[model samples]
Target: MPVAQDVIRHAAERPSKLAACGPGGELTYAELAGKISGAARHLLRRGIGPGTIVALALADPVELLAAVLAADLAGATPLIGDHTWDRRRWSQVTAPVGPVAFVGRPLPYAAGPPVRREPRPEDPAWACFSSGSTGRPRAIVRRRASWTASFPHLSDLAGIGPDDVVLVPGPLVSSLYAFAAVHALATGATAVVPGRWPARRSLAAHLAGATVVHLVPHRLPDVVGRSGSSLRAAVVGGAALAPGTREEAGRAGLHVLAYYGATELSFVAVDVDGDGLRPFPGVEIEVRPEAGSSFGEVWVRSPWLADGYLGDAAGPLRRDRDGWVTVGDVAQPYRPGEVLRVRGRGDGAIQTGGATVVPEDVEEVLRKVPGVGDVVVVGSPHPSLGAVVTAIVEGAPPRALLEATARTGLDAAQRPRRWYGVLSLPRTATGKPARALVAARLADGDPGIRRLT
Candidate 1:
């Protein structure tokens, strides 16, 4: 069922219960349902009814959530517009939607015949912007079941209840936060948006009334550092948590459930505490390696993968004949129901001296070294070998620790031959290394990066 269906259901069960809390104020379930119904009716009035594709340009977090739910209520697929995107980027994403209806902000609630409609499992639900490290983002269109099907998995992982407040620090435009907000609403838990304020550290400073918080690994420090927090559990997604970060968060009484998922693949795997990642509930993982290699392209079979790219017809999301999908990620051979070690994207693989090396394999090992803030491993052109493994380190960490760790933790061919240190590395919105910008800098021989060896 569409997530909007749950919102409507929750209103009848707990009309006076708090639904969402933000800087503006609070919305009880009845209020949220009323507000969402009003917006949906307004959208219907504007000809954005069943199956219509609507682009939401709301700035407020609460407004964005309301608009998204309202769009679903009206049985239209909602695309969250990014403020950072240019006109060209916007056009590129919505091209396949075909004559999209634009909703600048949520409209005032007006009483009328309910526009509520139950969305089909395969019906277009919403569009998610890919976390494209390559600088180009594709709007991945998701189906109603793709999201609603994973609600049970999320509920079990986070252990949220009606009284529990779920905190989403990031903007709703981020697929991670969007999922979190809707999940809270669907489960009848109060959704908390205590970030995006002047300080921006509002999340680290205060968690509002959140008992279960969803955030990326980068925000763990601030969240753990916050005093007088009512938070009991933290769910970290987007990227793996570093050893130091996990330990630090553990010391603060927050054992993070770090999830590894993508815009195309909803919840593939999750690592509880510090254990290795295992397939999420109802997800199957397969690693197809070369003739003799241990690491191979990771393929996933899930009940909730996205419907595929919307705007651009060309992308990496591939679904094979056997119902398995892959976004080109490479990983070590996975044992069913056990630890799955993902290396990196297959396209990002490095072949140096006939040996294949995944940058993520090197990056993860380097991140474990003390004094190493961040690392981005890439393949640089070499005369003899096709390409040599290279490492870009953030901060002037002593070269000895990096060198020793690489030699001990990695194979001879996988160790980075060239090392460069930067005051800070270029990063994406989610705090991951900006592979495209870094590769461009390396290609241009940018002097801003100090060559270590």
Candidate 2:
């Protein structure tokens, strides 16, 4: 794996190239390289090196990237804990790994000299925690080399370059942010990240000059509606981009690419020029069913897959003897020898009244409901039918009108059984709704939850 020092090597050769533009403002490659080196020196002075995990609790985008690069330079594994994570949670997350240095707070001087260590291709680079299957956060492991493998493609395939200004409207702690931050650095592109993704302001960043935008589909509709920006391309992932939204973006002259990948396989499948998604160069894809539009599991073998999950008994998601992996995303063949159509996440399937339904498929229909401003369909636990379908609406709607509209688009068993309304949906860092959080609100019977319109 090329260490942070190697990334710096590129910066030294092109010092004046624009490296980043975050809340900390714009920085040249030289300045960014210097920050990384300075933080590396700090870690080295603290006697931390290879295999060590450092907890980063700050929200500053540039500083977060710098600290991550610094850990790589020091040959230490950096665990990117959320800035909003409580100190107790922070302590518990870093408990398995070695000592952790909190990035934002001032640190005490080391009592010992620096330790020098080298990084390897398989060595852990960062540990990103996700609210796991049980709703508690668990670390998702990645290596430094995995990121470097996809570096060249950032410029070649993703249309990111020195002149491109890439704005990522999400937390740096998230895997997508980590990938975008590093990709911007590798390509010498300017990265613009907000402390939080304020929809209107995020669109303003693009209108101001951002050429590339990393966004979720939910936010894309609002972003597109808010600004008439000169955006050439948008990289949308983390959720489904409805056909309506894609058509809207097309009308806006913005190329909307529905990226299919996850934390496990960074930038695996990308669709360009509004074509269906396809595997990148050097990446191999295998479809399980090899049949019609009925989706099957997608397995990937790429040079960029992560090494393994740290301390977890279960192995990395679907790595075989041939180095293939699958994160359980379900897809169907879109076009012959062209691209695959991502149906929805495997775990998000809902069985309502003994009939199977995917919420994303249902949500696509809900998005088209005339009075529906925003909506999320989920399976509410039921005593008789296994799980009953429920719809959360955000816009003005009479319950009967929405149900009538939705019924026309969905099958009898697939339509939502319960309808509810809320001022807003609970969202993750990227403004995508958190099902668990939304469920909690529904369970609490908050007055804000009303009959769906």
Candidate 3:
């Protein structure tokens, strides 16, 4: 069944239940159903029908949710775009999927004929763009079943129910938060979204009523500092959580659940403890070892995999004849229960003096150093070594302190050859470090970089 139908079912059974809430407004199940019906009629009148691609650029979370459902009800595939996108970036992203219509705000309720088309399980449901931190973002398409199929397992794992209120503090443009909101609505839970980016005040207010929250690891420190409510669970992903960060979150009264996944593949492995992640129920995992390396590229086979990218950029979604797909993340099985220890992305591996260095390994060690807030390890150009491991730190700590910490924690090749301190590091919308931007700044000798040689 289409996800919209779930909302319709909820409206029939629980008309007075809160469906969504935000600073701008709140919606009961009945009200949300009415809005979705009206929006569907409006979309149909505008000539948006089956197979049509509609781009929604709205910032309001409630309105965005309604618009997406309405598009699906109208038999149209919704492509959600960030309203903050500038002209150049927007054009680069939407160019692949040819535009049909753009809706930036909620449409008026029209008393017109109801949309009669029913979306099949295989029908295209939604399209979301990649983070594009490495390059231009690509549009990824997924079928309705791709998400709904995993709802039961995910809901069980998340402990979501009708009484639960799920807080999604990030923008709808991010697939992570988008999934949180949609999954909440689909499962009869109330989705609480923030009105704006940064989401400090909005998050605090919603946390008072929210039972669960979706957060990126990098944002956890700030959120834990501000949040006072004791949540049942906090879902953290998008980037690796630094050492001691989970413990700090626990001290703040939040139980953290970290998972590893990609845009192409939905939820792959979920972190059971500090060691690594255990595969999601029913999901198959395999680690194909490289010729001369202990770590292997991680492959996943699951019902939640996306169909493919919308346009010509299809090379990254590598698949084999057996229906298994990989996003180039390298890992190894650490336990018998299908647990995996992710090494790093194969593309991000750095070759230095005939040795391979995963930046995440160095970053993990550096994060344990005192006074270090955040760290991103990258390869910088060197005279002898092809690339020297460099560490970019958020706060300006003495070189002696970092060097001392590295001496015991890291191997000789894994140690950072140079350190640059800055007030902050560049990050994507989802809070992952913007490696490309950081590399450019370092290469161009940005004045903000304090060289601790």
Candidate 4:
């Protein structure tokens, strides 16, 4: 069954249950189903149906979820566009898809024919753009079954149930938060999103009844300090969770479950005890050796794999004849099927002198240094080595502190040759450090970068 239909079924069975809560206010299951049905009729009147793409640019999370579910119910593929984009950028993104109608806000309910057609399990239910931090964002299309197939496993992993309310703090355009919201609805749980992105008020307001929260690692520090006692699980992803942040969350009585995945492959592995990531139920992983390296590129085969990019062009997603796909991430098996240590992306590898260093490996070591709040490692231009490892730190720690940390934790090649202190680092929408932008700033000699070497 389509996820929307599943939500509707819940409404019929439990009409009084709370389905969602946002800035707009609380909505019961029956009310939400009515809104979805009304939105579907509204879209059908606008000539959006099977084989037609509808672009949604709503700012309100409640409206956004309703519009998406309505599109599926109407048998049209819904592309969730980023509301932060300006006119030109948004136009450029949707030009290729050529959606029939672009709705930025809630449409009026004009009594129209009810949508009777249901999308097939293999039909494209929704579309989302990649983060585009590395390059241009690709339009990724996912089939309905791809997501529904993993719902049971993901619900089990996160302990999601009808009684639990899940808080997703990020924007709906993000795959992590979108999955959280949709998963909650599909499982008859209430999903609470902030009225606005980067919610201004304390997250405590949204956590009154929420037990689980989906958050990026960068937001964990602040949230851990102010979270309510009801917050039992913090599902951190979109970036690596720093060791300090994890410890802080533990001290606050929050169970931090860090997951590792990409847009192409959903929910690959999850870390429950802060040790390492183990594959999800029914997910398969294979690490094959790369030339001149001990760590191999990680490959995944699962039921949750995306169909392909929208235009079917070759991009980061590489697939073999047997259906295994890789996003160029390199890793090593710690306990085969039990734990896998992800080194970093193959393209993110920094070649310094003669050795190749993954920035994530070096960044992990730097994050442990005293006075270091956050850190990102990138390759800087060098006269002899072609490229030298560089560390951009959030706090201004003394040169000796960083050098000593590097000396003990990293090898000569992996240790940063230069240290740049900054008040903040450029980040993507999902709160990950924009390494490409940072590297460009370093190359162009940005004035804010304070060299400590």
For residues 222-319, write the lDDT of model 1, one tens digit per residue. Answer: 67746777888898875455558778777777768888877788888988757789889899888876343345667899888998887545666888
For model 3 the local lDDT of residue 293 reads 43
State the lDDT of candidate 2 residue by residue for 1-453, as single tens digits: 444565576687888877777766777788777777777777877777776777777767777777777777778787776776677777676565545666764222233333245556667777775432112344677777677777777567666777788888777766776777777766767777774565566557556677888766666765564455767777776554555778888787777766777766777677766666778767788866522324556788877776556566242266668777876555664433667766545335454443446676678878877777788776676544556788888877787787777779877777888998888775544566655445545655768888753
At residue 294, candidate 4 shows an lDDT of 49
lDDT (CA) per prediction: 0.75, 0.67, 0.77, 0.76
- Cα TM-score of candidate 4: 0.75
Structural similarity to truth (TM-score) of each candidate: 0.75, 0.70, 0.75, 0.75
What's model 3's overall lDDT?
0.77
Per-prediction backbone clash count? 0, 1, 0, 0
Residue 242 displacement (Å), model 2: 1.3
The superposed Cα distance between candidate 4 and the true structure at residue 350, in angstroms, equals 15
Sorted by lDDT, highest first, which candidate order results? 3, 4, 1, 2
